[model samples]
Target: MQDQGLARRELIAAGLAGAAVALPPVALAQSGARAPDAPRSAPAAVRAHRVEVPMPHGGVAAGHPLAAMAGTRMLLQGGSAADAAVAAMAVMNVVEPWASSAAGNGFATCLDRKAGTVHSLAFTGGAPGLFDPAVDPAELDSGHKAVTVPGAFGGWIALARRFGRLPLSRLLEPAIGYARDGHPLDASIAMFIRRQQAVLARYPTSAAIFLPGGQPPAPRALFRNLPLARTLQGLADAEASALQAGADRDKALMAAHAHFYTGPVAQEMTRFSQANGGWLRMADMAAYAPLWEAPVSTGYRGLDVYCSPLTSRTGLELCEQLNIVEGWDLSSIAAGDPQLAHCLIEAIKVAKADIYRHAGDPRIVTVPVDMLLSKAFAAKRRAIIDLARAIAFPRGADIARAGDPSLLALADDRSRGGDTTSLSVVDADGNAIAVTTTVGGGFGTSVVMGDTGLLCNNGLRIGSTAPYDGHPNRAAPGKRALLGNGPVIVLDKGRLKLVCGTPGGETIGQTQFQFLVNVIDRGMPIQEAIEAPRFALQADPSFYKAGAAISVQMESRFAPAITQGLSAMGHRLEMVSPFAIGSIQGVLVDGSGARMGGSDPRRMGYAVGY
Candidate 1:
């Protein structure tokens, strides 16, 4: 055991030491140069790398360079962390439209330095009021029928109004500019466009914008969306007018909100939906509002981990998984040891079992979130794991009864195409925000509203269409779908420590779980924690098709001995590419107020601090 432990430690040390030298050519190509005619001030350092940027005042980590720079620009402009986050998200909508957009939905967790409290914002859009369960499943999965009311625009304006120091117009300018003047397309987005070419080609407007000349844009090619720019400009103008019209901030915010949900924007959206045989209506748009609530938290060692509550099941499941593993001496186990991986995977399976059965929109389902997160409950669940072998979990009713030992499995359901994006920011004042946003797959529904330049979300596809059978997450009208994105903030002794999250369909929770374990249990630096090879348990059937075994998918970077050990223990293991797992972006704030930012090497992400 000691020898194996030593080998794992040495391997990790070597990997971390070689990270900078091992910079992938693809990442370098994306971040190292600019087009000949591009502006000199445009970002040229947005690639995924292993180095963490340390800053005295603020830090920003985003999925793209231009977006990260937008956040940093806000911080430098005397905006709070919330303000920077809003700015970054708006820019993401413009630059990474394949992953997120102004017409998507999102969830955010913010740590207010002055208030000394953590808050959550749930802006996940729900199924349209007229949604029919009898609709063809294939149609409901894509096309106009899959569209839902978008809440991202309202969510951004709300965050800026409540916690930001800047006006909505100012916060949105960066995105508006990017949309109007054009920005260079990165390698990742270019690939997404190519992959979703057939889907985009079906929607003329979408094809006109994304598939220019009936082809995907080349990497670093200049791309502009004048219609999107005009739409953003209209919002900015309305926001500015609202701010000037009222002495009360709340009333001013209400006016701004009305402009999107109850005014011309709403009319345009509803008209488009109705004209296309979709279900969205003005009532659905006007009835929508982002909810502000307390975050769900669980203590791990001495740190308090907070995550989005309710609509997002990521936080609840993550806390449960952490609690189950907290009883183990994780540090004593070597970094890449099979035993450690087994324990973590087993805990993940247990947490996911409960997540599938109980997680849902709180307004519609009575999810026993508190009970599921209780330490006592975790202890009971942990006792079921056997260190010597892998255990297959029971399905449906057997899961509800914790004592059931029978193992019956169902075929896994393969996850379809959909992408999400994430960003993390920390300002000089110590305020922090972690945001996960998505339009539900690349270019969502491929339906761009006429002249609005808004691509509506296929959020309706997120809900399970299988028989409800009393399941908490069953498909329902006006109910938010179960989402994988969970942004997190960790605090130690009431002081902010880390803000992190990722954009990987079902891999979101698992990635965040491993990140926390890497930082808290293994004592790795933020960048090392993020860049470390990750392992995910493919226990959830939602992402795999029938006949797939409950297996562990790990980065090929692990030591051969570790893989052999897992196989010997009767565990099914599959090796994947080093960058196939998750694109996580994070910021770590130390006791002295210094901030360190890290971006995952899996995708084209950038971390900037100053």
Candidate 2:
């Protein structure tokens, strides 16, 4: 205990207080060794009643600790995993607004222990049936493109009905109270709003809700959103009514759902989108529904990895990159062998080639599944990597390919923003859920809604502008836009090992790949994986733009020898700060009824388990 206290103080003095505070729960026993006057009940023993997991390694859990505590509180209170996740999402909307909101859609994957099955939910907005692609570019970039029907509500309900043990109303209780009673401004939240103060001021309703005093809320100041509270309460009541036996139950739900799409919500949104030259219609909202689909998966060291299949190529590309490296003993590479870096960079490029070519909505592209993952193909692909030089351009292996035909954007676009939030949870019943939600880039086009007190997503602008230019992630209406959010789950011998994901636009997969390697391959703790320096081979469209100058501008930490070696073999080395390469949040459940949670240092997030 004396040593632990001394270490904690050292961390605070070093300004790594968050990391110190988020120490893994399992470590408490070691850290809390007793003193002569100390109580016999150890810290871990006392916490055993709730199994409060801690983030191992180091870092402060960003955001309001209360929100995550409330989620874990629900789990301790006998709520289902889905219920806890929903509670977490609602709380995050208040505490982590730069990352997620009720107005944005979310993706989730869950393992149903009782049913012995895995289910996927795509709470993503779709293109209106009547959307036309020929609209003016400027108009599309402004308001028209940002007006997708928010699909998060439908997504939450779907998961609740299928896997939740508690009623949806119960899940929403904490969020409603916070919205009504008010919350203190958090540092991260205040910083995000202040950064976007000029943009928030553009939307009357957003400004009115978030900046009533014509300024961003100061950290620790009390703030409230009564309208948002009413909306949440109304939804909760409607959910309760739906489960009740009354004609008004159906009517109430219908009204609430309709309000956002074609009813009152639509009326206000339509005015803004139209005024901004957007093409969204009230009908788009009325017709939206979150899709449930089979997840894309691959085996890594016998772990069955599952990911949302359609639209995003993150999962597929990840497998391809891994396949290229699986043939070699990474231990040889990690020993500071220059050849190791060269080979890994080469494998990344090969995998990226496949992403630029065939990864897209399964509805549109025939993803070359078998060929991409074959060991033989991976070996052959690995051969393309030179031991001494980087490949300046991406090249496909001996496999079939496709291209991204949806809307896409380059990083140079002044409109570009890349920030996201991830959340995960599990209940006492052994049900687990992982979710990643975003508004496409930070603050999402910097637009906020009027009546809803919500921030609309600019997800529509995530891909290549030239839809059929052979780019794998071009944007299109009715197509899932090229998303950076990749929520994932890993199972070992049919049991859950890890539930994780990240938010980093093109850097998402790259970060996740390294994090997983650190945990499964290098045996590093989750906190170490998240805080470690990382790198990525930008996907198609991105490399063509950022590739040339990145190596030149990068710092020396990457090693000129490494960059030169990779460049000699065929990689474009882009220097990036080790600041979250991607923000990751997740929970790790061990067999002894012990739960460990971790949040990435790069982003403001928290993981609470009880």
Candidate 3:
């Protein structure tokens, strides 16, 4: 722990105290990539839970401490950032078992430092062929019926095979050890288990693992999922066997992919889905494969922000928000300034409104990607913000329309919850990756796949699609639901500057926008930026919903004055605990060439480096 603290001060010195800028000898110095004349006030003094962890070679930030350690093990053994990311995610599946699972899906944005190229990988799964678009959102099952074809495993293999330097067998070692042996149940996982007890109890496989003694395990109790261990070990064994049979590394990796998707595990998955009246089929498992696509990007000041494209809508939402707010003089606004928050809130609402209206499965629908990202469109959207009062949604009106607030409640009763995890890694050679993975809703359908111990994701969830037939995001056969995973990579003049992401369902892009602004515009170090307060514009009417009641959910840590100012602007506010929102795991490369990592203290996340 002391060593970790030292690593934190090292980056702080390189970025804030000496290399980037010389500060007055006041112990609480703070600085980063802000405009030269901006105030260097108390941002550095704001006592974050932990200092940023710095490593001369590289570092990793993840949702769990052991997960970060697993990634660091790869970096220590001379692996690429992709190798670290894959290894970390494998561990994340074991430790963060509720939010992520072996059968879950996600998106990745990876950078090859040597080529200075960043790419987006969509491992999101498609809705089953028998999917019923007419099913009510509330009636969606918490078990097999809500499942989509599992995509995360195939995606993980693709990343490791294409960009990683280590074997899948070796990467599986850490996770296998933890699962075969046991890791203590921390408060976070225990809390998740408590909330998911009802769903977990419904399935025998889930009940056997998550509900010991017919109840959630106590914190610090040793928990082991030996079945999951064997499942991963089987993949490792499959890879090893293929290697022994004269197969190269790529072929061996694919062999493992086949084992899970086309072999025994896939058969088990399809069998269960078929017997239980679920949507999955044997063909869905066999046809599941990840796609590598072009990332969507938009320039923000001197930085270029890139995000995973649709099927996730992260890029469209994030890019449009940044582009609309790019018209404002945000750099001059103070960190806790209400004007700054208002600009971001307004842009967030507009961006999501546009996204929910037009974004959909690119394979099935022609998304207006070009026009939605146009500067002229952004200008028109920015014109909608009154800058004096919050915009409300009226009956039969869209997000772009101004509405009467007197028509709706001050707070929304519409509550839908989901869970996910994120990780960021940078290898010694400068390669970096940002990834967000999820199992849909909490514990993900809460249905563990037989002896495989692979929990299925409820990817075909409520928000991913709409109730109306003409909705762009309406569920359909073979159409990939909007999985809502947004991983990001930022570049300064084509050089990697930041790798960051979080898991907040619809709030993913919104939280990421604030994190970026905190680092670039506010001159905050990665930790400060991550630890800073954030907000979400909740219940922005989706394509199917006509009325928009503006409810801004914010971390209560903001200054009372700031909250009062936003309330005065006519924005309905709901203050939550600081730890209740998104958990952003980020790594930054400072101007001084120091690599720093910041894991959110909001959850049980941590960072590790050599």
Candidate 4:
């Protein structure tokens, strides 16, 4: 393909020295078989600017500013990465409720630097096990199902208890202070409140807090959560007591768990779920447990990547998608080549073919993980792509064993709303945590718990039903819901290289895929890579108002001629904004060993590294 020296030099410059970044052996061997097609382009350079911060022997925190600042504060206080992440998550619960809340769940993948092991913590909650699936779908959409056994609290506590150097009480102080005394609302929050005021007004509890006097608060209005502060303090007290367990060990731990799900707040949640047709039980709250397991993974250019387990399908799908593409030349595809997009999209389609058919909760479905990520299977999957024609099918070819009924159901999620939030923290000890949390939509279920300062999640409603076929994400009792929030960690040469994740319903996977390609293939910095205009392709029709939402910039360039061409080849298309396509955040270590990072500029995001 090219002189070895030049390739080696480029790899070294890109920080891939002494690394076995094995491309698909076939792709490498076929480099000289034929010249690749040229990429589509606009006359003007599409400016994808990014803000990169550098920290020397310090830390970097990203997502919301208040959350980032809180994490930084923790790091400065000599807390571990886990401590900082727990603090940041708490603040995000208070300030960025549009994205997530303590009432929902989260999954974090952390690296124990000293042990050189990757540990994954899934805080994702499940439906009350004893609940009946035959409950009215409408009621299930209401207040009762809203009360999940909040896994975020337990998950955070577990992380801190396992890896933190600071006391939980100290780690929680920043969020508690913000919630108690109040903090000025940022412009983004204010604007969102004004725009969604009518929608928010539907929920009395939310309307009272988010919209005072039945109107959205003015910009910079002080937002306070006295109840949340009390809840946080109660948790702090519980953690402090539990950490010092003794003769009354079980008693204190039980008290800590009780105060939220089964204590005074329990009545409010129980009443709401019963009225709303939810199936939550006091027993569900007390018995729910967060799972700690090794993350699902695959290698990319010598990097050992880790993602959440199959409780949710994101991790398996991630590996499957990458496996299919590993046999293709990503660099040729990303270096301004339309064929690259076509090929990558095709490969993704093939991987998803298997994902929809088999990927799901391992306890419920028997998935062929080995077959999906195998290089040989990838070659078989890749053979389906035709560079000249789009493979128009209901879904990709099934590369693995198929299950009986499709699990995904098309619930009326338009009402539940979906917005995802994510955070990343790297400590002085080199342990890193990347957590992606969501409430399944903005102000999930639009039903706030009375005076609890908690918004219930409609995670159950995410599953698909009959008319939509037996999709892998259908609603069911005790089944973990499908998620587009894929938090991931990448290790290079046994050292952590990147910790990152993103939001955007189903677009999360496509966004992560493109961002990874931007960095590892196009030679872009982490920020520029993530900020680049992105696109996605899922076999599902739901994501599209009318087919896929293509970028306006791309629309203007392609016109009817290109559309007709792709359409003739079978790709349905719609127009959308480039920025709205997806947003991502991540941290990377440069060849010089400097830790640099970036957040999406299109969002109200800030990345700080000292």
* lDDT of candidate 2 at residue 497, scale 0 to 100: 77
Please rank every candidate by lDDT, starting with the best: 3, 1, 4, 2
Cα lDDT, model 4, residue 20: 42
- lDDT (Cα, tens digit) per residue for candidate 2, span 1-610: 2343323333332232123244443333332333322443223211011112453321112234666676776777777777777777787776676767777776888888677677788888755555565554454333546555677777776676666666556777888888789888777778878988886787677777778789888988877877777777767765566557453434444545655566666677667766765666666667777788887777877677787665655666677777777777775456344575555556666676666555655665566766766667777777766656665554444353443333233344322445667777766666678787777666765566655656666666534232344444445666555555668888877777777777776676677777777667665555555555566654434442323222322233455676676555544556756363677776654555345667765655566654
Candidate 4: C-alpha lDDT: 0.67
Candidate 2 similarity to native, TM-score: 0.81
Candidate lDDT (C-alpha), each:
0.79, 0.62, 0.82, 0.67
* lDDT for each residue of candidate 1 in 1-610, tens digit (9 for 90 to 100): 1111122223234544433333223321222223222243233333224667886799789999899999999999999888899899989988999878878888899999888899999887888999887676577566888887787888887788788888777888999999999998887788888988898888887889999999999988998988888888888777677667764655665666787789877888888889889889999998898889998899999899999897787888899999999999999998657898888887887787776666777897676777888999888888888887877763322234333323234333344545799999988888889999988867777788767888877876634333333445556789787777789999988889999989987778899999899889987778878887888877434521222357789999888988898888888899999768988899887567667889987888899999
Clashing pairs in 1: 412-544, 413-541, 418-441, 419-441
| Candidate 3 whole-model C-alpha lDDT, 0 to 1 | 0.82
Model 4, span 1-610: residue lDDT tens: 4422223223333332223454433431213323232121111233345446665645655568888888888889898888888888889888877777777877888889899999888877776775556655565444555445567777776787678777777878988999899998878778877876776787787787788788887777898877778877887787566667652534454455566666756666666656656566666666666778888888876678888776655677777677777777777643444565666566656655566556555656566777766777777777777877776432434544555553234332332335777877787778888888877666666666767777766666533221133545455567666555668888888887888887766666677877777777666777667666665664333331122222212323333555555556656666565466555767887776667767886566667766
**Candidate 1 TM-score over all chains jointly:** 0.88
lDDT of 3 by residue, 1-610 (tens): 1111112344444554224544434343233423232343224543466777887788889999999999999988888888888889999899999888879999999998889888999998888888877766664548777888899999899899889989999898999999999999888799889987987898888899999779999988998999999999999999999999999999999999999999989988888778877778888888889999989988889788889998888888899988988898888998667999998988887787678666678898777787778888889888878888877532321333222122222222243556889999988888889989999888877888778888878877667765445656667889888867889999998888999999888788888999988888877888878888888877754422435677889898889889999999998999998767799999888887888889998888999988
Q: Candidate 3 regions off by >4 Å?
A: 1-45, 139-141, 393-415, 540-546
The runs of at least 3 residues in candidate 4 whose Cα sits more than 4 Å from the true structure, single-residue gaps closed, are: 1-48, 135-142, 194-199, 240-258, 261-268, 271-277, 394-403, 406-417, 463-473, 538-570
